[model samples]
Target: MQNLQAKGLSALVAISILFAGTGCQSNSASATPPESSKTLDTAPATAAPAELPIISERAPTPMGEESVRGAPADPSAGTALAQLETIAIKGRAPKTGYDRDVFGQGWKDLDRNGCDARNDILNRDLTNTVHKPGTHRCVVASGVLADPFTATTIHFVRGNATSTAVQIDHVVPLSDAWQKGAQQLVPEQREAFGNDPLNLLATDGPTNGAKSDGDAATWLPPNKSFRCEYVAIQTAVKAKYGLWMTQAEHDAIQRILTSSCPDQPVPTDEGGVAVPIAAEPAPVPETVQDTPTAPVPGPVSGPDVVYKNCTAVRSAGVAPIRVGDPGWDTKFDRDGDGVGCE
Candidate 1:
């Protein structure tokens, strides 16, 4: 009975050992990690940023003095459209007698501003302009042109070959003006129309060629952004000179101006301050006073006389009036030759 009790105690001890070992193995296998750990190497993926627009470093300033239509319209588009509306709608006239000379000698100092129209426009439109040597700022030697027609930067150097590359364009081409209403204008009016800075622009040569005599209907600036301003200028020129437009030309202009630039102001007097037209001297009243039997003329002084300063002479009429001509006076002769108003 003592031997049997000892064996039974040993078996109980072995079973207890086996149960403890199984519990330890199960605990080790089932253990879990803590939730508050930092194992990530990078942030999650996201969409890329958008691209920006292209902007020119040499963009031109919007010049107020260059406004050709005088005081700005409250809504430039309405004023421009109203002006455009006034233009008579008609078919293009025949180009039969459209001689360039009909407008008068090209490039007159019509404004009497010392510089010819070409140089005046160049100085107005170009940046960093260098004047021709000895020309006293009357001629452009070199400059940077922010060409409106092509929206490109051109380095302008004055020479026969290079000069043509920067030609002066008539915004309202002379031929177009002639057909519209310029045929009815007198010689002086024609000259004014031709050299009016409002009508002219210094533009890219190739572009000008492509746009020869084309109204707004046929051509527009290749630079899409510049089309509104270009159309505005054309409308202003047509308005100033009483020129008309074709059905297609009117429609095209209205589309651009009314839709795009309805508030675009007419450019004032080309690029300069506007000058008021001078009143003509009261027509010399016919004199019925009796002439002396003997020669009674001493420098020819009377209500019948019309002597004016040199500026008035140049502004009112052409230059180089001779000593005995209708409007000549010895006072205007700078060189004191037989010619008085040269």
Candidate 2:
């Protein structure tokens, strides 16, 4: 009886040992996590933040003078449609205190090319150009303009009566700019804005007149094919000058760009923002004892000194010849302000 009882105890001990070994193996397997659980355990603590909203792309709220001053140097680097996205949309400002003189007396030689902005654009946009004989090609005597606004071929003759046939149209008109953000620009910047060739185009005079002070919402080139380029040019100008657009204007430009010419590139050119340098005032000469000298002859009056044109007059060191001065002719006084070639 004692031997049998001992055998049962031994069998029970063996079974317990086997069960313990199986539990040890199971615990070893569980010590290393399953592949799926391992992946979950090693995963990043947090997801990447969601992309910032599109609202961040807009100009700062309450766009101020600094906004106008922060124009990009090369606003034409991108597609016009994409560039339009960067411009601010705002209501037009009051037109008070706005005048042609607010920009400058007239076209300036901002490029310092020895020619005014008017002639520069004329030379640039016109074909078969004929420059004045002695003007070093500074003065455009005549040219043929493929007028974009009217989609017509127009002859441009530089004369008081005929010059108006082809006029330089401001892609973004001065008044429109003033009402937009130009009111915040300094005088020099305003002058630069007025003369920027990127904003100027040679177009049909009557058509330009019809587009006076009008934005894309109000004016578009009559030629349907040119509208895309026209809007693109306007967008480029506004972007270049840090000028804002009205919501209507923005919408109009957006519609044209998206619907018609999605790939339209901003017209990039050598012509850029050219601010005119102010001429330094001549230093005051030291006073000295007067020496006996011959009386300087006053400007010759009447037609005795006949000048073919203003170029000849300037060459003779007698520009701005007054109405009664020699070589003075009504033809030379384009503005008819009694001053010829002033």
Candidate 3:
């Protein structure tokens, strides 16, 4: 009976030892997971490096040639802002020796288009224009102007009483140009600068007068919407004529271009070609009547005659003094067709 009892005890001890070994192997296997399971646990860490490319892709690249140091690259190459960067800044010169005649006596036919500068601008800017009957459409008899200075529609009629209502405004006023860099230009160049179509605008007469001799620093268009275009035109003119701007003027123009129209291009057109300044025609002899009675009824024949007004011209019997005729003057040429008292 003792032997049998001992055998049972031995069997029980062996079973206990087997169960302990199995538990140890199971713990070892669980502590070290499979290679695929380990990769899944570290998946988030691996994904971190993938985001680096996305960040680098958003960086800005340079455009065209490199710009001036410390300045932002031009949004577009050859834009007004880029052009503005090229212009020189300087103090304004004196107005000494400045005169309207220095630019030339009056509007000239610089374009050689069979029309004077004033009439050309009038024809170009005014809508629905009606020209005089015998002026080959060179004369703007009547028209509607979308005046940029005042931002209003103006009815333009060719007459002494109403012609002044829509006057041609120089984008860079003559006096302002004279003070900037025009004094150095030759007479032909100055004349071309004065008559260039790119510099002319048919604006409200009062506005033109108000803006007389004012630069971008001193004056701007009353029409806020047109201010960008106005400044752009001024910049182009100054650049074309090799004119410099005051610090204030340059800053004003730069402010407008950057804040309002960053991409505005410098305006381009057929600029005036320099031509030889024509000499004044020789004066013709006046046939004075010994008895100075009522003025004779016909065209006046004396270059020295200065009529006070169109009515005076009529009283002198020179109701229609064609351009180049004796006694002809721009003041009498209300329609600006190179004809006076018509």
Ranking by lDDT: 2, 3, 1
Tell me each candidate's RMSD, in Å, in order: 17.0, 18.4, 16.8
- Candidate 1, residue 250: CA error in Å? 0.2
Q: Which 10-residue span in candidate 2 carries the lowest summed lDDT?
A: 61-70
lDDT per residue (tens digit) for residues 1-342 in model 2: 999999999999999999999999899888988888988899778888899754212122111112111134454487899999999887776665666657877678776767777777777777677877886776778878878877888987877567767877888888788877777777787889888888888888778766756788878888898998888888888887777887888999999999999988777645645544435422222222222222324555555778887656755656545556667778776543344543
- Candidate 1, residue 228: how far the Cα is off, in Å: 1.1
TM-score of 3: 0.60
Cα lDDT tens digits for candidate 3, 189-297: 7888878888888888878767756788779999999988888888878888788887888999999999999888766554345434435422222222222123357
Q: 1-342 in candidate 1: lDDT tens per residue?
A: 888999999899999999999998888666633333322324455658877866323212222123232234445345666778888887766554665557765477777767777777777777777876786666777788889989898988876345656777888888678777777667777788777887778888778867866788878889988887777778877877677888888999899887787776655554542323424422222222222223213343344546676445544443334445566666655322233332
Which regions in candidate 3 have their CA more than 4 angstroms from the true location?
1-77, 271-342
Q: Estimate candidate 3's RMSD in Å.
A: 16.8
Model 2: lDDT of residue 59: 20
Write down the lDDT that model 2 would get. Answer: 0.72
